[model samples]
Target chain A: METLKIVKIGGNIIEDETSLNAFLKLFSNLEGKKILVHGGGKRATSVALKLGIESQMVNGRRVTDAKTLEVITMVYGGLVNKNVVAKLQALNVNAIGLTGADVNSISSEKRPIKEVDFGFVGDVKKVAHESIDKLIQADFIPVFCAITHDGNGQLLNTNADTITSQVAIGMSKLYKTSVYYCFELNGVLENIQDKNSVIKHIDSKTYKYLLDRGIIADGMLPKLENCFDALKNGVNTINMGNTDMLIKANDNFTKITL
Target chain B: METLKIVKIGGNIIEDETSLNAFLKLFSNLEGKKILVHGGGKRATSVALKLGIESQMVNGRRVTDAKTLEVITMVYGGLVNKNVVAKLQALNVNAIGLTGADVNSISSEKRPIKEVDFGFVGDVKKVAHESIDKLIQADFIPVFCAITHDGNGQLLNTNADTITSQVAIGMSKLYKTSVYYCFELNGVLENIQDKNSVIKHIDSKTYKYLLDRGIIADGMLPKLENCFDALKNGVNTINMGNTDMLIKANDNFTKITL
Candidate 1:
């Protein structure tokens, strides 16, 4: 099977122009078919603030009310995603920016109201792998933002990390997919203060041990969950590290294995 | 050759959700291959105003400074374009949203600094007909906003009318192309005040008569230029009318002939 790389960047990297461009330059150099997924929470919040829209976050998840949804649509789907695609095009990469609604590429149902009404938040129901495959086969690198539709005219906010893993899992049916989660940290470090004390390899048993000892919690918790989920669902290789890991062999980056 | 319909909507329709939705429903019912080209100037100006960015217009054209370019990217590329795509998808049109940078489908050069320096504005250079054709042949409708990119990485503000004519002319190389310019008016009116004064046919002689009489001056001047240009090119048919003209046989609309 052919190899495919799916690299995901967080809002922190997207917020910094220098870092984002630097990461994109490296991404443009990666060989073979690839995909870029991005988030724009920081920019969305800033734009919303300027528009006098207060952002309410419940337990680290954004409460995507009606107005917040519009902010993200403009920020994530428009400003950030298009800028990334344009920069990539300049780097000689044929990048096509998209949301779930484009070609019905991704579909999600509104999150059911249980503990909290997430308003227009979407939990992904399907990823149109065949449609995406057509674009990839046509040599077009897709750049996706964290926006999805209900296939019923509703736009919804979604988690970018979830989108990354879901795309990896979906594409694995056609190619051997390797997923990368690039963030601000070196890796999942043994100590938060020590960047060099990276847990280079993380297996199922090691992941449990680290979690029980409070070493892996909070935001990292959901991230690792996505990594493992991708691995279990046909995505072969999953890595978590800083943006630099995509360039060179970095022993400091954490690799997830079964 | 198969027929292709390129529908261009002015910003006024997009500003009102009810009218926009009504128009979209009519557009969705259009037979065979079609493309939707849109302008979001009103919403962009409003958003820019809220952001305290004073819009500069010289001869009815927006002076797209760096900040204004970002504003258009969000309003046109993000909010308006995606909403339209989602709505079209709900109508089962299988729409895909794109800009010039996406797949390198369109390319333009920055307008030169003449008497009035139009900052970051693009003048059409080339349209990637094959790239756009691939999407249409795959049964995906393309919904475009007034944005294009320089090959070097800069995104520029483009006029939607120009984009519509240019795309129609480009696509005519492979298909029988028909372009519809749907504005607020019923059609190009013989008398500005009378609603029933719609000009049914506008050939070169009649158009020259109207121009000499000062009836077809200002904004309508450039619009008619686009229609005639498209007709002169490989495009076979061109019409100017309200959105309702697409739905049925509207004798009130104007049809351009060579």
Candidate 2:
């Protein structure tokens, strides 16, 4: 059997109804194998603000303090996860929405990055592919939120891209397949402002050269790093581009190579 | 100071974009006291079907088996809650999406109903209205999911109507205000098919008469019961009718009287 395809949707794609519906329509036609992982930082930030709570962000990652964690739990684990599942259903896709804590499907440890006490932030350490595989075998697509459990059984907020990459790598190792990072942008661009300036392909060396030249900044840096990591961890092929472009195998995507 | 009004929306209201937007528009203008509690049983049922998990219902209540519990968590607590919050936000209304388990704000105990093991279903035993009131005071509408936590700290899926009623009753006592159950229908009818044949008002006596006459059946029964319960719990007024009628105090609604 072919290994499953793991797709990661950024906060930008999942934030609005139009993009969400578009993604769902494409998702409905997806054949073979797939799993979806989504980010909820933007939604979380908006909710936090409404509640008069100031979100603390350090280097684009949310500083998940106790109060922020509560907001995140409501926004990510409770809100965004279901929204995606509902959209998938509206498109007639059989999607099973899940959090890592649900069945211990994804396990992690408190990241505590850079000695900053980011309360409940997690770094995913294990992916229970077998359970997810069973659901997929039963023809249900697993729609995952980026929350996970520390091995000692505490709920922690993990980065969505990291979680998506971990799941893709885990699935690839289990079945030896490829993983694709799908977003609103048309792959890694040679020039950020120009739509037609997408870099068609890049080796590990070229990717580092672009990063060194300051071509990737902000969110895209982490995304490219995640792609690089996924490739290292048994994932044979990694593609990053617009969701529709990926579905149609359009020439507007960047294929990361060894 | 005048007491704040807490308006609770049923899951039926939040099922689609048109109804949701309609409710939000009406809600936006109604300044003063407001809180939103929504149902997700319909969406949960649809998701359960898609996942090949049979959702068993006993006495019109979802018999949330383990798998069904998972589905409800993702659908009701996650998807439906966020969508409502987002819609409210888009209208520039500060809305905070929350689950009962988020801050131990709403606590319950799982009461296995009539020998059926409704895996994680809960009956509302206690509600901490202070936190919710604070949010309302800050001009933030707290949108809640019907999932609650057992005092011992287990998440139990509760009926949205029951939860909304409890929250309304609790808030009414604390703030001494009215709670309105707004729907698409004109209110409880003498006949379901005849829209104009609305029961103008009902008390305990008329409530029993309608039940005995078999006018109120199925899902409408619980809503009526909840309305009566809220009235009994010292809520000053209970309006059961269409959104426009409730907002404008239109004469077409069936007011539940003491």
Candidate 3:
């Protein structure tokens, strides 16, 4: 199977223009079939605040109201996605941006109203592989924003991490898929404060130990859970590291194993 | 030759939810291959006001400064384009939304600083036909937003009419293309106040005579020019009317001829 890289970037890198461009330059040099997934919560929140839309957050997850969903669609799917595609084009990379609605690539079910009503939020149902595969075969790199639809004309706000994992899992049947979660940190750190304390590898046993020992608690728990889920579900490999990890030959990043 | 309909809708139709959906319902029933091009200037301007971004208009044309361009990308490419695609998907019309940057479908040169420095505005240079043809062949309706790229990392604000015309001209090489300019008006009215004064057919001579007689003037001039240019090129035919004109086969619309 041909190796395909699925890289997911958070708002920290994207909110910083210089760093984003630096990362895109490195990404443009990668020599294989790849896809880029992005989240734009920082800019979305800022714009929401400017527009007097109170962003309600419960348990660190955004409550996506109608207005908030519109903001994210504009910021994530429009401004950030297009800018990234254009910049990659300038770097001579053939990149095309997409929302799940485009080509019906990703379909989701609107989250059920629970304790907190996350209006217009969606949990992904599936990622259509054939449409994506066609673009890939035509030599176009797919760039995705964290927005989806319910196949009933409703645009739903989704988590970028899940999008990355889902896309990785969906493409695993046809390719040797490797998923990378790129962020501001170096990797899963042994010492959270120390930039040099990068953990090179973690298996299922090691992950459970880390979580039980509280070394991998808090916000990192769900992220790592997504990484492990992808690996368990046939995605060949999963890694977490800073943006430069891909450009440099060294696997200085944290690797997840089954 | 297989006939392809290229429909362009202005902000008047898009800014209204009921009308937009009504039009999409008719568009969904379109028999053969089709493309939808749209502009969202009203929403963009409203968004700019809410975000404290002062919109600058010179001679009724928006001077697209950097901030204005960003707003339009969010409004047109993100908010409007995705909604249209999702609605079409719900209607079971496989539709994919695109900016010029996506698939490198449209490339433009930034308008040079002549008298009015229309910052970040672009005049289209070329439209890539093969990528679009591939999508159409794969049974996906291409929905375009009036946002293009300079092919050198810059996203530019472009006019929707010009985009419609240029795309029709480009696609004429592979298909018998028919361009439709859908707006609030029924058609080119002989009397601006009378809705029934639709000029059913207009050739070059009739068009010139109308303009010379002071009947066709103001905003309609540039729109007519675009239609004539498309017809002058390889585009098979051009029509201007309300959205219903596409559904009703009576052709109670203005047909531009050379």
Per-model TM-score of chain B: 0.94, 0.86, 0.95
List lDDT for all candidates, in order. 0.90, 0.72, 0.90
Candidate 2 structure quality by residue, lDDT tens digits, A20-117: 77887887787777788888858778666755678777767558886676567666777566556645654656565666654356778887657466
State the displacement of the C-alpha of residue B198, model 3, in Å, after optimal TM-score superposition: 2.3
Per-prediction share of native contacts kept = 0.83, 0.13, 0.86
- The DockQ score of candidate 1 comes to 0.83
Model 3 C-alpha RMSD vs. true structure (Å) is 2.0
DockQ of each: 0.83, 0.07, 0.83
For every candidate, C-alpha RMSD to the true structure in Å: 2.2, 18.2, 2.0
Better of 1 and 2 by lDDT: 1
TM-score of every candidate's chain A: 0.94, 0.89, 0.95
Q: Candidate 1 DockQ category?
A: high
- The sequence of per-residue lDDT tens digits that candidate 3 reaches over residues A1-258 is 999999999898898889899999989888799999998858999899998999899878778889999999999989999999999999988898899998899999999988878888899999998888888888889999999999999999988989999999999888999888998788999889898899899999999889888999778888888788889998988888998788768678898878
Worst 10 residues of 1 chain B by lDDT: B249-258
Residue B13 lDDT in model 3?
Answer: 89
lDDT of 3 by residue, B1-258 (tens): 999999999998898899999999999988899999998858898899999999888867678898989899999989999999999999999898998998889999999987788889899999998888888988889999999999999999989888999999999999999888898788999999999899999999999899899999899988888788889999988988999887766678888778
Candidate 2 RMSD to the correct structure: 18.2
lDDT for B146 in candidate 3 is 95
Name the better of 1 and 3 by TM-score.
3
Worst 10 residues of 2 chain B by lDDT: B96-105
